[model samples]
Target: MLTLRMFIQKSDVISFKNMEDLYSRLNISKNLKDEFKSLISELNDYLDRYSPLTINSHEMRFEKLSTSEPNPDQLTNRELMDIYLYGDYAHLDSSKRVRFERIAQNNLFAPMGNHVFVTIVNKLVEIIDRAVEMNKQAIEQLKDQI
Candidate 1:
């Protein structure tokens, strides 16, 4: 039932910076926390290694860029990926422009012409899906126990 809008919501993404924080927010049991931590660690490593850099509002040329922007420092990996996936980058600096071009080259026929961005976003979505499935399994177990 999760829509793209829901998945990319800034408010929803703000709570989780890393797996430990996510576990805390979900109130995961200590026993399962370790497992989830391992999975999250792997996902984090992949994101760190492969995710694109995000351009801040200051870097964006568009007028009407929000006066109340989300803290750049507070953005989660998924949020960062979302920005890279969806934000306009036509006005990026030289280095960022080069990087964006490389991404575009890799995705020549891609819907958005940004294969790296798409790959990272898909991975992030997978991580969220896994977390949701885990929560559902846990809830079902609790229901059975009751």
Candidate 2:
């Protein structure tokens, strides 16, 4: 995740965030573009599903956020990065640490959050892998033509 934060995320977000603009700049074949479009759509969906934004973190709960709520799962992809960056991995920001600690101290978030965090993270990794592979193949094909 650190590597993602430092290096890959910059490019990863750009490549997928606005596919129409990026696609307009590319010289990919029709079939390849279609495939890329589908992949990008799915990738973006998962990316949206899992974000680093912490706005909704306050609503997260172990079993459920509220008894009246339908899903109860408030965990977002955005909140996971905080746990890794502030709570566990870097552990630098005092303010973030406090927030993360409060969230972590929750009876349910401590254990179940780990499981949920890892599962979604793995899915993100798999999507990123596919995007990287496709980009590499496209670039290599372009190189061959040159």
Candidate 3:
């Protein structure tokens, strides 16, 4: 899980769609708009099996922010990073360590099929890229104004 965390830290975001949606719904930041699109693309690519970003941490945890609801909980860019930057599914269960190891060793995301695994990888990458992009743009803009 710690490895995953580091992977996410080094990984970059380039989309602001989710960020913009959050802002529009919550009035957080209007500046993340343009960067969000690029982020989404970047994430989509990063999470792919061929991408350089991969899990490496042994101790990662996902912090539950709110009670489950019909609408997903709102996530800031940093919070979003927490999700992908953490452990893989089996990390949640110690009993599954052996099973998880098998999959990990084989580099197979799923035993039944690779499609679902691919989809998840893509999703995580997409989300991370989007958030990273928005955050990057905001930092750049701040630097420019200074």
Candidate 4:
């Protein structure tokens, strides 16, 4: 008997696009065509990367803002000028947004301070959610076959 190990391989990114593409090429089923394509699009969007800003509350007048741990760093003058930083940077002005986008694309700034670390954490969460969704959809499809 083939072991479960035989069914799965390492290095699988487990995106909807990969799954749909693989099954469609094999001509899995007519009923699954539309649903599979839609799932692939959703999965692709979830996996797509978006740089976001992270914020930690320092000492605040409000009790809600109080935190025992403080963020490690803040942006430097040079970093603030970069465009990529705007991906996560929140500003009312479009000009500032453009500047940050330039900074990020240039890779001119390093992730500094508590806010940057928070942004990293947030991105990690998004990654996990996408992975989970992809795996779940794949598993459900497998179950239908069995």
lDDT: which candidate is best? Answer: 2
TM-score of each: 0.47, 0.61, 0.34, 0.28
Please tell me which predicted candidate would have the highest TM-score against the true structure: 2
For model 3, residues 4-84, the per-residue Cα lDDT tens digits are: 344344332312443544444532345465446455556545443232122234422223333343122222333323332
How do all the candidates rank in terms of TM-score, highest first? Answer: 2, 1, 3, 4
lDDT by residue (tens digit), candidate 2, 1-146: 66545322444445455544565567766666677778767755654453322324446443333334334234455556555566666636776676667667777556655665676667767766876777786787678778
The CA-based lDDT of model 2 is what?
A: 0.58
For model 2, name the residue pairs that clash: 51-77, 51-78, 52-78
On residues 19-76, what C-alpha lDDT tens digit does candidate 4 reach at each position?
5557576434455566556654543443232223322233211122223432332332
What tens digits encode model 1's per-residue C-alpha lDDT throughout 21-126?
Answer: 6665654466666666776776767654422233343332112223365435333345445444444332234554543444344433233334545666677678
**What are the runs in model 2 whose C-alpha is more than 4 Å off?**
6-8, 11-24, 50-60, 63-73, 90-96
lDDT head-to-head 3 vs 4, winner: 3
**In terms of TM-score, which candidate is stronger, 2 or 4?**
2
On a 0 to 100 scale, what is the lDDT of residue 56 in model 2?
45
Q: Which stretches of candidate 3 lie over 4 Å from their true place?
A: 1-93, 98-110
Instruction: List lDDT for all candidates, in order.
Output: 0.50, 0.58, 0.42, 0.40
